[model samples]
Target: MIDTRLSDPKLNDEQGRVLALQRYQILDTPREAPFDRIAGLVKAVMQVPIAIISLIDSERQWFKSCIGMGDTTETTREVSFCTHTIQAREPLYIPDARLDPRFATNPLVTGAPFIRSYVGVPLCTPDGYNVGSLCAIDTIPREYTPSQIEVLKSFAALAAEELELRRVAQIDFVTGAATRRGFTVEVDKAIARYGRYARSSALLVLDLDHFKKVNDTWGHAAGDAVLRAVGAKLNALLRATDVLGRLGGEEFGILLAEATLRDASRSAERFRKAIEAIEIENDPPIKVTASFGISAIGPEHATADQWLAEADLALYAAKRGGRNRSCIAPSSAETQLSRPA
Candidate 1:
């Protein structure tokens, strides 16, 4: 029931810290095994029932890896001891919550988990923002040894490293789309769901029309600008459930969950129109269009590669039937005829 207004004095550069934290995009995401393992190991080492990898959001402390919390995923920032640790930007050790004036009145201290002792190390980002903490909590108060503190610090650093590495691996460097590998992994899972539930899904494989001409005439820099713009446009067209990735040079792939072939065609048309509308105010004002090949998940396709090949065949048909259009493949084993859009 305490207000945290101006209470956490050590929350340095609040705006920058928030921006850095958002860059990780770890909040509310499914618990990852790496983070869970860290929390589990910390719990084992500290012999505590409660251990978590917590991210301090604007209004709450959200656990990315929670163990022994009994379905409690988050707590309000006002009562969060992890929030205090993040503000301090260092390990916070409170042997007895009742003995500490700061936490004695906290609801978590008086209420659930009845937190009696806590030792938390700040998970600092590379740019010096303390985003959250890797913490161990005990219902009964106890002191931590100096060796225990060192081990906890190492674990916190390990969690930070993993978060950063995963962030890099998830995104495409140039277009900010999912990387090819990331997209492939996601598609595998999506296909598995489609197989189990027989859900309708669509794949679109697209390539820029006359992309090499842009690279040759306007140079690679201009080509990169076109690619970046197109990538952004395609991303905007996607739903939250859909995933698009830069498959490779001048090519991108989209996986539309629960979408039919017609839905896929409609989406592809939108992408083509969007790219065609991009008038780069260059010396000559570069304009571009893209060709799309759409394929629905059917009995013929079981793997990501097979689905992509189906889309590629349709895309080639789009290029052949004149560029700047979408072509959809029939549900047959081979792409015999492509329906142009």
Candidate 2:
């Protein structure tokens, strides 16, 4: 968790976090070459038994790739030398973990893995969040020249820049979703081969109701909280296969590939409830809600735009009927209801 008491250094830090992590295409991925090469070189050059390209996430420091290690790819940030390295933004060289005040009792140093000596370089994102670290660890104390430390930090910066550029290229800055350009490029391939590979797909358009009221009554900060809340709900409720993106302010879009209208509605209703349950904790206290419209593509549909429009129309009808409800399309038919009121 981010420390709430201290003034946030980067307000946009969380916005790009998901996107930055995703762009690496590294998490949960099978271990591979590029990162392995870097890790291998760290062990060879630094003469340490362990080297890792570690990415610190919300809960843990996960290794994108590693070498000279087995069955110990990640650990909590509380026990990480990388966490301190990130904050200091300098090489953290602990010559003797048992004697240093900052690390004397640290678990990773005193407990299993018994790190007696450590050196780590912070990996910073472009706008400057310390996203991770490149570290070499030894079981015994060691000394390194200042020049060697500088070189390792330079390499960490290069790796961080590579990861940051990928996020800048593919994600929406505001909502942490794939940019429309990125989504369009990918969605076409999915639709073109529709049933040949997968079944039908569904599109959903969501509009937050009384959003202007939130901004008017509480301020834009409150409005931002509402938007982030909505995004978080959709992100949590949707399946891994579904693609969710914020189309623009107060409006979001989703693509549920291989999902039927019923399946889409089920997922949509879950998100609806999730949003309704959220109570934004901004000063003066704020409560927010949303409405959703859904449309599914059958074999007869010709274009993605058509499906999006259908969802939008249904969303409009949902607004007209009432806020905080869901409307499913084919406007001629009675709208399908989600959560009552």
Candidate 3:
């Protein structure tokens, strides 16, 4: 049985909170020793049957590390105790769920794992959003002292710091987009999601047309300025779910989550036009244009490199077809689609 009247808990700044969570790029990633060790320590120190490092996403509460919950990695947000945990700054301590109206009919309480005691400390980001929780669960009623709660909060801070370190390393200094390594990691996650859930997505690789000429004529400083401006402009045009990254010099990559080939084509065209419209205030004013290559994630691609190679092929096609255009790689069933910007 479940509580039919239990409403989904949400933060007042939910959109901002989810965006802050996404900035870490941690969801669906493989477990690391730091997080696993923290969960293990919590379980040991708290003397709980289960301890988890959980991240609350839009639709699910995903466990970055789980101990004592057999093979279960996630649960629907509708049924998650962690959902309620993320709504506040302080730890949520339930001494006996069976006595609490909120959990009296909750599935996790009435069913397997038979959770009775719980404590969750919200994992707050640097920007002050509670993105998830570090929780300890027990199958029987138990009491937690203020000292115990403080210990959990200290663990939660370490988890938040771990997330911040990853975020800082992923960002590009000049463009403010993900660096090459970060972007590729995102692509790998997208691919894993596609394989597991059949979620469709597309990748767009953009290269500035005649970018060398900008450096030769204006100097490296001006070239850097152009990259920065272009990054900012493209970022403004993107949805919160889209990932923008600087792949390398004069090149960028975008991961369009849950988008189809047609959706990607339209997006690529828009980016092409946006890049073409960029103007830098140089001695005589400078304008720049970009070429785009798009490839939809599919079964044919086994690795991120293969997916990127396909997009690169389309990019070369765009270059051959004359720059300032968007081109789609030929699928197994169809020929390449190239559109002038």
Candidate 4:
């Protein structure tokens, strides 16, 4: 008889555990080449059909990059075996899921995506918390040596290093969004993909409304707080494929890959509302608004700078008409702007 049991993964200091994970500030981020390369390397070297850089949160496991999984990027925490790996802080190897009492009854094994063998190495941070795992899965039972587990740990080390390196290079120290240079690199790739695949894309350049007044009245410290809050709010609303960056002080940019102007407009309106709703809890409370300019990318786009210029024009129009609104550039190459939306 096959052993069958439903195991409930334990959560320890789950609040601080989540806060520790957030310190990396990597959740819901766009796919990066370094991470994708690692996942692909694991799939090829380990000879598995599926490999993923899985980050486990309170309710779900999100894959920043995956190999052989197609377009699917995540699953609920209940179905995530990585959840168990993180709890051990070491590699968890299951030669076969069906025969394992801990996982035999799990939906991931019995359901459509029938997972059999699994090897997961914990992604441990310098501060000694395992936020997630680097996992490879297949639909067949297989034997893997401890030596193989060592190699998995080595690859996971590289991934952790890449995460830290990107945090220093790409992330804004204050807002925790991509810096201007980092954002440009990502946007360039999106533009190339749009040109090659004929995918819909949009860019938004946003300037905070009356930011100078905040610095003058409440002090630059409060101004910094406001920017940080805005970045956090906007980042939450983005899809995993979307990129948000600090283009400059009190101004930001968002690259909406596989999205249209109508979608961009709705996002802009949402931003407008969210910004208006922010109430900083100082003695003198602070509230703010933003002006957004939208530009749709075309197949023949030349450079990131050119596209940004188009969106900048649209933003200028929004400011000219009045603040706290969004506008579109009307065309890709032209600097001509349209009326505020």
Candidate 5:
């Protein structure tokens, strides 16, 4: 079970365990090149045999990437050096773990792992939650000068930047939703989690109607205005857990976590009506509206891509059926192809 008793001011359950782990989207992923580079740089800079980008999860510290270590993850947070680093929200420098009062008797130092000198910089979120650490360990006692510690902190910052860049690259710049590529990654993650834990989720595809007409009549500037307006309104209305993105043109998408068809439909309708009510103003008023296709992932599906393709088919059906209405994909519409709405 996940530990609930050790709540500290710097590491609340939501901020530290849930949000921190979720933001990276790195948990359970196969090793990657960028993280490998981070590990390599840490080893070279600190001259340590072990370096890791460890994320402290609910029950374990998972390595997104590691160097000079065969295991991808370690399951002992209660005794982890990273745990102390997170709690301190500072670099935990034990120049000699075997002599340090707090860690002299630590299993990591006294037992099989035999960690000695250790330096860890907390991996902090933008909101100031210190979730984990980027750390290096050696088998011998060592001291880092002030300059060396600062350099280690800089490396930790680089790791943080890698994480933030991953988010920015995946999220839609215009609407803050997942871009097409990002959506694919999301679906893959969702399906993997569902396959493991058996959870339900929903997807919605939206396209603005008569968007070209808005550009033609009011000029492209007005069209841009309408898109931005709609995007802002949606961002304001959706739950923080929900993901939204514009996928180019007047098309957009949403991933509604842990939502049923009824709940998803309610949310999609709210988005629909919100856009319908957006009245653009100049000397003349221009109004905009959108159509949506919504669907839920069901078990026994072949893959996430196939499921998304079905949703896209339903989107085509909604467009064909009517320009400004919402349509839900019937469970029977499981094929790659779509029908007219």
Candidate 6:
């Protein structure tokens, strides 16, 4: 029988856990040496054929590092032992897979890999969310000592620290939003997820209207204050799953996860109004407006650059159609304009 705690929404904070995991922006990214070395160390120290650093995504278990699983980067959550591992505070130890009813029919156990024994420690964030697991696997049934479990826990701590460090490094200083590199990484992951799941998502590229004049008239310090205010306002309006980033200068980007073009249009309109309402405290208060360009992720978008280019085009359209408006790609009929009345 499956553990109700793992499967039931009321018993666990799955949405929060997934959001915490996404905040690290590690999903679908290339393998890093730190995580790879950790997996290698786990394999060597535990004398196991397979060792993995797994991040439990909403629908799948994605491996940041995997040894002994040749070319396999991910698997569905249903067949993943790491899924169960993430649910508990203590290490999950299955000494014999064949004997455990949960594993008797699991594809990983009965088919390839043929895992007979497994031990996994939850990779818990500093705030207490279990995002994934660190595991050591052997082909034959075996019992792991308490000392060994402690070693695994130590490694898991290191992994969690790496994630926290990355999250800190990804933030833009002035705006308190993601930096260009960090935002681009998230766009890449969003593209990969769209390819795999066909889920609808959209990107909005925004540039503040006449931003250079703000710096020219009020000095750079005032400009920075305006940028910070706009960033905070946008952050307050966005959902937990949505990503906001300072792409450079007065330009920003927002990744609206699981939203359609229509949804993005409405959101962009809201953001435009919010930015217009922002007042920066200076010798004289400064109010600003932003022009928005939105592009829904589609099959035509093969890369982040492509997706961004489409939105950028729409942004240009918004600029031409007059500022403080939102435009959607591929058609003028979809453009949403909020001119001064």
Listed per model in order, the count of residue pairs whose N, CA or C atoms clash below 3 Å is 0, 0, 0, 0, 2, 0
For candidate 6, write residues 247-320 as lDDT tens digits. 99999999999997779989999999989988887767898999999998877788888888889999999999
Q: What Cα-based lDDT does every candidate model obtain?
A: 0.85, 0.74, 0.89, 0.84, 0.78, 0.90
lDDT for residue 8 in candidate 3, whole number 0-100: 32
Model 2 whole-model lDDT (C-alpha atoms)? 0.74
Candidate maximizing lDDT: 6
- TM-score for every candidate vs. truth? 0.62, 0.54, 0.82, 0.58, 0.84, 0.83
Q: Candidate 4's residue-wise lDDT over 258-307, tens digit each? A: 87777888888988899889998898789999999998887546789988
Q: Please, what are the lDDT tens digits per residue for candidate 5 over residues 1-341?
A: 33423545546554445565576676777888988898899999889988988888777787887777677476577787887787665688889988888898987789856888989998877766776689988888988888988888998988888887887787766566667777667777767767888777788888899899888988988888888888888888877667676767888878788887777888988999998998888768888889888887677555767876777777888889977888888773442233344
lDDT of 2 by residue, 250-311 (tens): 88888887877788888789878888888888666687778999887655445666656778
Each prediction's RMSD to truth: 8.0, 11.7, 4.8, 9.3, 5.1, 4.7
Candidate 5, residue 22: Cα displacement in angstroms equals 2.6
What candidate 4 gets wrong by more than 4 Å, as runs, is 1-155, 332-341
Ranking by TM-score: 5, 6, 3, 1, 4, 2
Stretches off by above 4 angstroms in model 3 are 1-22, 44-49, 67-72, 75-79, 105-114, 192-198, 332-341
lDDT, residue 256, model 2:
84
lDDT ranking from best candidate downward: 6, 3, 1, 4, 5, 2
- Among these predictions, the greatest TM-score belongs to 5
What's the TM for model 5?
0.84
Candidate 1 per-residue lDDT over residues 160-195, each given as its tens digit: 999899878889877878888878776776687777
Candidate 1's C-alpha runs over 4 A off are 2-161, 332-341
User: How many pairs of residues in model 5 come into backbone collision?
Assistant: 2
